[model samples]
Target: MNGLFGENLKYDLKASLVVFLVALPLCLGIAVASGAPPMAGLIAGIVGGIVAGSISGSHVAVSGPAAGLTVIVLDSISSLGGFQLFLGAVVAAGLIQLILGLVKAGVLGYYFPHSVIKGMLTAIGLILILKQIPHALGYDKDHIGDMAFEQMDQHNTFTEIYYAFIYNSPGAIPIVLIGLLILFLFEKPKIKTHKLFGIIPGPLWAVIAGILINETYRFWIPGWQLGGDHLVSIPELTSLGDITSLLTFPDFSLIADPNFWLVAFTVAIIASIETLLSVEAGDKLDPYKRITPASRELVAQGTGNMLSGFIGGLPLTVVIVRTTANVSSGARTKMSAIFHGFLLLILVLAIPGLLNKIPLSCLAAVLFLVGYKLANPAIFIKEYKKGFDQFLPFILTVIAILLTDLLVGIGIGMVVGLFFVIKTNFHRSLVVTELNGNYLVKLQKDVSFLNKAPLMKQLSTIPPGSNVVLNAVKARFIDHDIKELLDDFIETAPNKDIEIILEGFSNHVRQKA
Candidate 1:
């Protein structure tokens, strides 16, 4: 039991610090993308770690304001007329998620196809690579949030990449190049073998280097020194009282609005699904192979979302990036997750001014590597060899995401995958073989309405005046269409002098006997 709370104290502390560093920029960036105050993202991180981490059944899954929910939050805040009203909707969403957990909706997550998930991850990775080009080149015009393909400032994604070189920050380029070099160098297999280098997480080193370099630039190269727009920005706080003032309470006055309920419902369903998927992914990443309790995870997330809303924060999900960072940094227990929340709380309250000095390009370098890892071409080729059934949906998903957003792209891939599923089932619905002066028809495990066409086609080819054996020994489910087809065949077969022997049709065989 003690082991779970950072039982390996050294490992947990190092991992917690790395996750905190990775999350700081991301939390603020996602909030900015959501059209909420930067502080809202931090608040959600605080609750996600302390509150959600405490109740969640997952040992590794980290909760925080996720980029996936940015569209929903942005739209909700805009349509609701104010941030406070949207907070009310978030609270309602939490309650609805609680009800969903109670009803055991967690199993629904399993319904998502594995290929579709791979496609989703690959698409996100590609998007990250494409979008981070500007930040890497030190063009921070749209640095705070780069989730959408079409920028709110009227610039599209590709143009921003093209403009990055033309308007690149001289100081930022060196910082990014050096930062990326250090990051890549540290990840070498040999460096990982060294005890000293192994203990210092790569992202932490990159951040420290970025901060010192930026400070040095300000000292010597003041003209090209990066400022707030090109750096991480945590609002400086004078005291605990100042932090207290920033907390916005949720306004429950609009809770009665039917329209509000619809928004809440949307949030709850999407959040739950996203949380469940993250939990599954986290459990897979766990070195110990521990299973996460999905329903309980929903409850924990619900509690965190409600607390975040109460404090005027963006909605939280079981965020995959932070969880992956936590895992990669060798987190041993839930304590790392809880400690991350504590760190966010202290960092925001204690040293917001100092944290802001870290260059945004350094963070972009980190995400760039993360994106490359997720969308590795090796993975694409691996799935490609699995044949068209897997590769088609996977590539289509990546292409669709390039054209559209994440959720829409996943939906498109799933729809395509479903067509393949039906097509395969239709082809396998029935089988026919010929024996000594007789015919045999074998029914598969599931014979549904979709199988009707193929089944009839196979049955129609049976030779006239030939004795037939209909086999259903292993058929678990026979839909009405299949049964009616069999009944009509039995009635009309006499016209062709076809004698049929039925197997595994208990009632009909008994009646004839």
Candidate 2:
């Protein structure tokens, strides 16, 4: 017990506080964005920090409700007919993820194309900005977390922005503008390095500033006061009984629904991919250079999601944003994660009224910044510079998700990425170049049956009376079809008056031929 709490306690304690502040607004905002009760996000944050932190092999990785999953969660709840039914999907997903971890299937994350994943994130960013614009302008007809282009209120993404201008609230404008200023100020490097500012996150300050400004308007300028739907509303817990009553359980009866299983499988796969990617990024940032066992991480995330779902929380996954903050704050162990969870639990249980005073516009502004970061123009330029092989899938993913839904968009991106891989493979494996009267045919990679046609075509194009060099030194494996093609070419070389120079296929070719 002493050793557990003695060594590195100071550093971990300070880091935990910083991470908790950073996570607080994000948890609430993500819940509001996901159309779940604000407390649900808090529950996931606590479970991720305490349960996942305890079980995961990672020393500093932090888990929570992610912005990436908000779209799926919102869509699933509506399609499943109720939040209770959606919780069942979360539970099932946790079970599937647990089974995957036990069977050592964590390596599946590597199969996903990098371009597709980036595109998915970029799409989510765009959705966040579009959906949050209404809330930021005080047009609260739709749920704060709605991300679909079409709204339940009969307005589309762009039309909603037009409506926002027509019905803009006088009070929300100042609150959001001031909130953004605070957040942006806190993000500045000089202020971020300040001891007080560094310890307290920008979003928290934005929330505080929003609360004070609204209260001030309420007293001084009643005409510009914001209230009701414009403010965050959380179910306050006053006693132990209230706490139990506030916690909800999933509907196990939904297990027979095919849609439930589909949602489950989708959540499991995406959560696992996000978890593996976040943990890998954490390992890269670790000063200790400690490697997190990917399989163990999946198990930890699965356990957290199960508990979170049972208690009516959003699905859980390791979040890179919080994890980066944890590491940068000098966290040395998982104890910091556990401590941050306790802090979140304390905040919701002890002072939900304080959380309720925060304006939705403040949260919207925070999300606006997040969206800009994810869909930054610089990201597009970077991908474009990487060539069309990467940019095509990336842009297609963003377009597909914006046009359709998350799952279908990802599917489209994956198919496009695979097509590029096959097309590039056929064109890039063998190279035929001519210099003066000599021809050099180089094997850039392994020669399989896929390369037979290209190899034959290149060999056929060589002019008569030219010297040809067949270079297979770079190829590790040569298929029988390729070898046959080479032998046939050599047999006909004499007829074409071409001299063949064999560079790397002594064993594969016949001496007589």
Give all candidates' CA lDDT scores: 0.83, 0.82
Q: Tens-digit lDDT track for model 1 on 360-399?
A: 8888887777778778899899999999999998889888
Model 2, 251-332: lDDT tens digits are 9787888998999999999998778867765776678878788898899999999999999999999986677667766788
Name the lDDT value of residue 392 in candidate 2: 99
Sliding window of 10 residues with minimal summed lDDT for model 1 = 504-513
- Clash count list over all predictions: 0, 1
Best by TM-score: 1
Q: Which TM-score value belongs to model 1?
A: 0.94
Error of 1 at 391 (Å): 2.0
TM-score of each: 0.94, 0.81
